[model samples]
Target: MGFLDISHVTKSYGQVQVLHEVDIAVQEGEFLVLVGPSGCGKSTLLNMIAGLEAISSGDIAIKGRVINGVHPSKRNIAMVFQSYALYPNMTVGQNMTFGLEMHGVPKPARDAALADVAKLLQIDHLLDRKPGQLSGGQRQRVAMGRALVRNPDVFLFDEPLSNLDAKLRVDMRTEIKKLHQKLKTTIVYVTHDQIEAMTLSTRIAVMNKGYVQQLGTPKEIYDTPANLFVATFMGSPAMNILPATVVMEGGQPHAEITDADGARRLLRFSQGNLAEWADKPILLGIRPEAITDPEGADRKSANIQPLANRVTVTEPAGSDTFVTMTLSGKDVIARMRADAMVAPGEVFDFAINMDKAVAFDPATEARIPQ
Candidate 1:
């Protein structure tokens, strides 16, 4: 058993079932992020873990001990909520120590813990101030400090950074990462932001419509999505999925797709197993970074197919330019270096890294194993 285990867990209200057979085993000190869109049951799963919501069935255990019937206060877990649930009338230090006081902890011990955590979170100066006197970021730090003083076995973050502005969110994200590294605590963070999942997680569970679509390391989920939904949901520009047919050429499989000018083009497949799929209709998947200007193509790829296609749109996004063109009657984006001189309505030689390509069964929408 792992440090935290959710086995065969299901949740339902009345007759409408929400979560089905959800299972996850989080190792000690592992940063696991439950990421998905709003109402995907990520928060519900988290609440179940925190004992804020009871499991309809199955078990939730911590350190091999069942906690399904335990109270939220007795669960040995700390939660940093999105709203920064702090008392407006209480000073930061008082708010931080109130939980310990409620548990009958001695004043001296609570004070010591408060001092240490406040210093660690760099909020020692704000300890005497009320929640209303602090800025948003300071209030967040105080909320985190309150949880830190408890030194719980598990940390539950429910979209904790969602309330902060963009720049502060990034700053606090780094702070949280540093805190985790120093403390090495097990954390289950829930966020609707895919970028947070990619940047912060040791493993990610991507949920959709109350089901976990896929669970794996961020790299694995991004590079080899389990299905079409994961592919389209987990990235910034999203993976470009084009309708194509697998055709055999020179005893190898090639994706037969139409270019901008309505001319058919062939790109060789690096996965030799695709040869078995010859003459079959399949959806070709390629990330925008895999399609770039010739000079920006990945040097490690052996199969860099070259194609001259007319660009329909060019978006300059500071560090890189997003070039869009029609392929297989779909808008395909190519990520190119900012200095690449190609413009819209011009025929440009683009390099496609077929080595990074993936394929999906058109009917089932599941990824065809590489």
Candidate 2:
């Protein structure tokens, strides 16, 4: 019921099932990124959409038409591979237009399409050169240009920026985002890099162990993870999770955790529904940024609680300082302003923004719903 729909899609290799009951509805002109660790079946699901891998069961449709049995060429989909996959011997212009030529298109139309896409991708100067003569970024642009000239119904990218250097990867990421905005094309991109997924996708499908742990906008995924796997996987520094107990204090639910000296400390939660979990053990999830120096705490947060703890280590990371301490027998990190004056073995008053805190069912590893 979407522009690109994967309804009850599953893929199996003989007796072993890799992808299970996966469903995603990608809207028109939307950018969807499949992100997870290596061997998590992100690429396998992408291959299924590209018609390179057969679906064991279920259906994949584009614009309401099922393409389950369609050939790769006839599916009206263009793909850009991680390796660029350009012809080494063919000129850039030939490589870009060869697919059109094979479809029996006239030479004039092929030339016109090539010129427009090459200009759009800023590769007009490299059309006469071969793939061997260009830089890594230029070759990537050529690969993208090849796909753009086809005017396919969908564009599938299989870790296309993974081959570039770190700086070039960032540069290409911006370029791809700009291209998507300009053309308003539907794109399904696959990457294991969470940062790439966060920055590029309009929506992200965070997969793990052959399952989509969470599918949501970046803000939703970061702010409210569906489960423990999503909370730990999608962020750069990762969310801090520790064991805690829900205790009622003054008719309000509070998280009771142990500080560095094994002293019981209480931090009130913003979710009033947690009152039902009174006297029950739960896993508390908090992002590093939510725990900060008293002066650096979020001013808008209504539930800022003071938590004094001994800092075990202080890491100055240019823009922000990451302070580490032990709480609930687990290492907890706090992000503070780089200029904050706290050192190792010093007791600092850290602010806990309970407004941004989340609680999880420790046994099921699922987030506690508000």
Candidate 3:
């Protein structure tokens, strides 16, 4: 059995529903990330699992036992919220031991727990200091330390790193991943940040409008998204969805797209099991990394179909560069190596790696075979 099972879980407030018949099975020691945009009910689902919010319908089971009616304190689960939720008046030591104290744990046992957690989190020196004196990252660690001290069955993180700055957030994300590896604990994390989800999760559930759009590993979600929403939401520069028509060329599927000069190009997809979608009205989804400048020697093997287009803008972000160009009357972003020597208003020959391209049906918004 799965470590935690959310069976047809639903949540509603008064007359409105926030979570709709969601089901997720979390394996032991697995890091599962629930990710989506604001108002998508990711946090609501996490809260329900933590017992902070009641489930409007369905059942939640941990280790094959129903926990639907269990009180938060008796659930054997620990939560780390975005706000840190540290007590201003208490020292870090006291904050970490508070839950144990309430549970009637002996003083000697509680002290040992605090010592172990402090050492694990690398915050032993700050145990005597109050939350007010610690930096944002330090305080976040203390909050996590508090949860770690509990030695609970599962850990629920509700955007725990959201309050930190970008650099600190990245640092803390690495710390959390290392911590989880050491502890081998089951974790369910909720966040709207796609980068966090992609980097930290063993599996990710892409949520939208109170429903799960797709659940898969990061590579599966990135390379083969289940639908258009997932295709657009998972990538950094976002997948470029171009309107195209599919036609059969020698019994194979080829996507026809109009380039900037009103010239038509047929990009063939001969990947595994793509013969089903021979001819259809589909949207071509391509990541920025899949498109490259043809003149670059590194992309010699990348099916260079030279498309003439004037670059509208160029953004250099250290390791890579992004160029914006108009294709089929829609703007498309291309990511290339930082050394790519292309300037604005320059017409360049671009090549797309059609082997990695994806196709989605226009009507159902679902991925097609080709």
Candidate 4:
């Protein structure tokens, strides 16, 4: 058994069901991130774990004890909300200790606990100020400090950094990682940002339409997605998926795509045993990084095929450049170094690292077993 287990959990609001039979087992000190787009029911599942929302069926167990019907406060799980849910009327110090005071803790004990958390979060000076008097980043620290004072079994962060600006979010992400490292506590964080999920979690659960699409380490999810939805959702630009037909060339498996000019291109994948799949239509998934300029090809890849393709769009994003081209009548994105001289309406030999390619069955939208 894991430290926290959600066994076949489901949730509904009267007749409207929102969460399916979702099961997540979180180990002690594991940082699990539940990430998806808006209204994806990630928050609903989190609420169930926190006892803020009722589950229609199934069990939620913490440390081997069922907590499905436990009170939120009694769950011993502290939550940090997106809005930095601090009391505007109270000073940061008061906000940090309010929960303990309400629970009948003595002032001395609460103050001691608050002092420790304040020091840990480096917000001692801001403790006398109210939430309104602090910056967005500082208020977030206070909210986290409030939760830390409780010293709960699990930390539930419901998009805690969502309110901060991009730069602050990045900084806070690093801080949260460091805090987790020092505390070694289990964390279940929810976010809509794939980048946050990638950077923060030990494992990420990508959800969609109330169901968990895939759950794996960030690298596992990014390198080998379970399905098409996951392949397209977890990455920054997402994996480029194109329809192609499997063909055999010189007794080897190859993915064939016909260009707009009737020219057929062959992409040899690293995985073998494609004899049966030949002549069958399949979806090819490739990340932008896997397709680059000749000089930009990943040195570790065993196979890098160069295609003379015309660039339809060229977008320079700081350190990297993204170029769009057509393959099999589908737009494909390739990542290149910022210095790569790529321009629209120009035909260039693009290096594609097929060794990192993934194949999916179009009908089921599931990755083909390699």
Candidate 4 lDDT (Cα, 0 to 1): 0.92
Q: Higher-lDDT candidate among 1 and 2?
A: 2
Off by over 4 Å in 3: 259-261, 272-279, 295-306
Provide TM-scores for the models.
0.98, 0.98, 0.95, 0.98
Model 4 residue runs over 4 Å out of place are: none
- Model 3 clash number: 0
Candidate 1 lDDT tens digits, 1-370? 8999999999999898889888899999999999998989999999999999989999999999999999999999999998989988899999999999999999999999998998898899998998999999999999899898999999999999999999999999999888889999999999999999999999999999888899999999999999998898898898999999999999989999965567899999998899888999999999999999888999999999998888999999999999998887799999999999889999999999999899999999999998
**Tens digits of lDDT, candidate 4, 1-370:** 8999999998888887788899899999999999999988999999999999988999999999999889999999999998988999999999999999988999999999999999999999998898999999999999999999998999999999989999998999999999999999999999999999999999999999899999899998998899999999988787899888999888888999887889999988777876689999999999999989999899988999888989999999999999999998888998899999898999999999988899999899999978
Clashes of 2: 0
Worst lDDT run of 10 residues, candidate 1, spans 258-267
Give the alpha carbon lDDT tens digit for every residue of 1-370 in model 2: 7899999999999999999999999999999999999988999999999899999999999999999999998888999999999999999999999999998999999999999999999999999999999999999999999999999989999999999999999999999999999999999999999999999999999999889999999999999999999999988688999999999999999999965567899999998999999999999999999999988999999999999888999999999999998897788999889998989999999999999999999999999997
Largest lDDT belongs to which candidate?
2
Q: Looking at candidate 2, what is the lDDT of residue 12?
A: 92
Q: Candidate 1, residue 4: CA error in Å? A: 0.4
- Poorly placed runs, candidate 1 (over 4 Å): 259-262
Task: Compute the lDDT of residue 74 as modeled in candidate 4.
Answer: 93
Q: Which ten residues in a row have the lowest lDDT in candidate 3?
A: 296-305
RMSD of 1: 1.1
